[model samples]
Target: MRHPLAHALRWSAVGVLTAGLMCTGLTASAVAAPGSPPDPALSTPGLPPPAPASPPAPASTTADGLALTPPMGFNNWNSTHCRAEFNETMVEGIADLLVAKGLKDAGYRYVNLDDCWALPERDADGRLVPDPVRFPHGIKAVADYVHGKGLKLGIYTSAGTKTCDTAGFPGALGHESSDARQFADWGVDYLKYDNCNNQGQDARQRYTAMRDALRATGRPIVYSICEWGQNRPWEWAPALGQLWRTTGDIGDSWGSMLSILKKNLPLAAYAGPGHWNDPDMLEVGNGGMTDTEYRTHFSMWSMMAAPLLVGSDLRKGSQATFDILGNREVIAVDQDPLGRQGTVVSSSGGRWVVVKPMKDGSRVVALFNETGGAQRIATDASALGLPGTAGYTLRDLWQHRGYNTAGTVAATVPAHGTVLLRVTADRRWAAHPPAVEPGLDGDPLAVAGRTVPLTSTAADLGRTTARQVSVSLSGPEGWTVRAASPRTARALRTGRTLRTSWELSAPPGTPTGSYGLTLRVDYRAPSGVRADSTLPVTATVVVPPPPGESFLSDLPWVSAANGFGPAERDRSNGESAAGDGHPLTVGGTVYAKGLGVHAESELAYYTGGACDRVTADVGVDDEKGGHGTVAFEILADGRRAAGTGVLTNTMPAAPLSADVSGAHVVRLVVTDGGDGIDSDHADWADARLRCRSAS
Candidate 1:
């Protein structure tokens, strides 16, 4: 099956939409409608309009008042490590710089210390204490200093038996209430709750335990969950915490950042005001990234509405670092009260653009160039579904400046760099109100149901021109309707109807699952000019499972690796840390300890080097022995090493005597030729890698 992201948008059909010479703001009349198929999202209503968002709580007063927009402040784990004790002087020094550098005034009022704060052992009362040698003033004194600087203090703890620091500080399992009370007593404003060793309990139970515990302290503490996506927290975390780390630990590398962001685009629905999808912490202002990469990091994070937990050593940053961290335009989006997180609209050839709708009716757009070479990116106003004659104002967010843009505005973004733009209408111009086509209601159909091919047939919404049309549906379950097309069109409402034109080719896959379909229209026309219009288009899509296989069992991995045979086997015993089946000669036995350990196996010509460093071609056959067995040989340059035994496809009746071949390595290969297969799964519990190595 094709990936959804790859077919979400069309590249060839892409074009620009700009205002006409005669068109001004409100005076614009012509609507150069892009041809697209009808959208189904408009007619449908999303989950009963989410409940009114709560107000922001006082950062220092409540244990759980109201959640805030963007989480503020700095985290120390990324840039430095605390040894025997957290250096109180270092913390105080950074606090001083934070105030002096104006970070506190910019809504960044929290200074979080991550781990390494406790002494080797707790006191008799099980109370965690700061190491006196490093913190002569004590933990309370440190918190007080941060508070004096007008900043809140955040601390970290594990839910496991031991902290990540390996310190003896008490964890928050059975003693959650106690830990919460202790943190409140220490004046800790934020608690970074880690999910390290507490794997037995579900995230909800573990998290809720802490949440209720903290609330019991009558302390308003922000709960940050770090489970590494093991439990898909987006489905339940918002109700318990202010911010949730949506990805794994962040490394200051372009690859790591890109992987994290791309993986997170689909989870946008779970993020909003008071609830955030954290992409770990900010790596901007850190030396690991170049100026361009740093800019990309900050822009992407802002667009994603991620928390602004600057991880750089603020006191030592250069001018470039300061500029990257102190970018107001980028920060505004992150701090927007609307709390909307941007999702990817289109991406291709490593050149992608993400558009985020802001509360102010403006848009935050980030154009990223992940290619190896610089390239230019330009978008027409029409592509944004604006009136035929529309005018736009472009604000280069990085430059902190705006420019009047018509037709197309282009920029040359460097490789691995980004262009951040805040696109809005010029205040001088009046915005055209969107026209609501009546009866619009349709959604992407599920893959299993029937499918109605979109064609030139009017009944099937075949052949089309550009006009925003809604795909409506009437079904018992409010069936879903999807487009198998190339370009990403605007989904209107309820993830059903969308803003589109007749020309939109069906998205690349087949549309299925809808019991019925119709098209509604949405455009900006004067209410009196014309009432809502309906373009009724209907058809049925029939999709069935593949021959002989149920949908679930037909998945890629299961189909490719399923049972055991002389030629193949399913080594995945569903066991933890146990190696798969052992590949041995048809009549040979593999001598080994620890019967089951999950590890990989393969068969390839052995390179004459240390076994650890040797590379294998994976699934290859051995045609040697002409049918003979070689003696077990282990030699380091023909000298003796350790193990005493012969290693070969031919097994001996008894264990061989000890012989040190001075071998720091072992090599096994087919003296004759055999078919070469790469990555053919194998097992190794009772056998050895004959023609191929098994695990």
Candidate 2:
């Protein structure tokens, strides 16, 4: 996603960074403009636009022979969005986690840094350099650190003049060769080239320039072109890079993942060995989708051979996520020697049958149910182009069980879920393995700092006495679950149900939000091996920040009060002020540091503490339009705490303090004064609250 803000920081030959002298709280859509070719997806009915004339094709990226299988690893873009998380420490932490958890053993390599790497301007020699503050030891040192752990380092750059200046990162516009040489010099193993600040330059020409530059460096960097798939990279990208994005940035939800899948579904033929299609990074462990949905997502992506650069905070991943992402069997299908992408052979009544042919004479079929509820779907062997054989065996990859292959392969698939079955010939029918269905009695929701009861049950679905029936609760960091009886009856006999329960709570600093709770049941059949289930449950914890002055940027929810426009968040301290052209000043004071955004913003807090002091610094935004007169106030339970009597840009922050010992609600408001409301980038700087513990 090339933020519109980047285009403002174009650099002059002398390496000076300058943006336009303007400030209006006006924002632009990240979406493409009308009449611009919609980021290439199957066109909506009757809205097909004219296709472009075929351009001359460049030599295939196969000449370089990289990303033979879609690259697997982690990228920082989604997890941190170039904020504090996009740093050397974070990258190192990810590498450490990957190694600690055996993800490296499962083929997850390449810890890629997405955007926000370099300082805002080029060096005196017009060469790009790392932001000394973020990468203090330099890019080479970071690469060496990663290489020491048997992992590769991937970096980001823009194909345009300026990278996303939104993060103060410089670009490789005219310094393609310099940047490429610098990257090779740093031992970079991969590059994610973005399409920001290109100034309407031709995408192909610019990307080709970087490709040639990288080749000239005589290094093997897996090139990933991230132009938001605007030009249908699948049709023309094979010659430019190992893989190309086939759509805009992906959202971390069923709708978003499915949408990206649908778009890339039509382009599967274009994905093969050496050159593959990318549908953006994986959001598997993120909070948007359920474990079932992630399973479907991972299955689909692997079937399509899409790169699996995970986007979640790996250090916070649960066992379920690690299992889904580190499944060597599914990954093997994706990284099959023949490198053939899967194709949806049939779809009807909301059920889909996708088949991928492996290098060995076997086929991986996925029965997908996209309906509102569970559905029993069947598959046609002929549809998969499988050789007619009577002794084919069905291997349930996820369940680690086997069943007889049927011409009409059938399974009762859960809603929005998938049943991935790998079918192989030259085998006899075997009895299906014993299975266990694990689930929680009720999905619970509670406030932070409060305990909730967790009750789970395991039902034996086969005639197998499962032993060692125990249910363990797992969640992301900051949460813990303690069970009264985490273990079930010594053994769960066939045709019986075993139940276990737990008490779970979030610690003091756990932000109020929804989190995932996984119930991992470890059970074994009489033979000591059959099947086990990992069911995911959800919990919503609501806890306000501690009684102290919490910044708007750190709060859970801050919005426009009384139907005001949405509040703009600028975690990059001076970003908002600079956008408006002023020395980042707010509330009568100057802050050299954190999130400073224009106001028309309101923050709500639970002010039930015993202490009484509350204060807020207020002043006009520093940018050009940020100069308009604005009003700032601190209110408790709809009453005023402090206020700045209409301040202008020239004024420093006016301090407003109030006492609300018995108040239950605290609100901070930044609104424009009566004038035309221009330059009303009000800053509610340094809002603070003093509290006493209630014993």
State each model's CA lDDT, in order. 0.49, 0.66
- Clashes, model 1: 97
lDDT of 2 at 441: 52
Model 2: lDDT equals: 0.66
Model 1 scores a C-alpha lDDT of 0.49
Per-residue alpha-carbon lDDT of candidate 1 for residues 1-695, written as tens digits (9 for 90 to 100): 00111111111111111111100000111111211211222111111122124423323212345456778788876666444323787788778887887777777878888776777677888777777887788878999999999888888877655454433355577778888898999898888877654535666788889888988998777878765454666667777888776654555545345545654555676787777777788877655456777888888888888888888778778888877777777888888888777766566545676778877777777878754334555554455434443446666787564444443434545556788877666543222222222322221222333343332111111011213333432333444444444222232221132332222222335444223344434322222222123333322232322222121111111001111111232232211112323432223333231111111111111211212221111211121121212222222332322222222223332222223122222222111011111111222223221111211
**Ten-residue segment with the worst summed lDDT in candidate 1?**
17-26
Candidate 2: tens digits of C-alpha lDDT, residues 1-695: 11223223333232222222111000131112211343422521111222333434556676667888789999976656656557899899999988999989988999998777788778899888788888999999999999999999999887766665454356677889999999999999999887766667677888889999999999999998887666767777888899887665665545446656766766666777788878888989876577888999899898888888998889889999999998988888888878887877766655888888999888899888654334556665667787776535667778776644434455656657888888776545434433455656533545567777777667654444668777677887877787777466678765577777778887766665557677777776566664456755556554434655555445554222211122434421222223322344653346543234433334555554444877656676555333455576667665676766768778766777878677655666555454223334565556566776632
Per-prediction TM-score, please?
Answer: 0.54, 0.60
| Number of the top lDDT candidate | 2
- Which window of ten consecutive residues has the lowest lDDT sum in model 2? 21-30
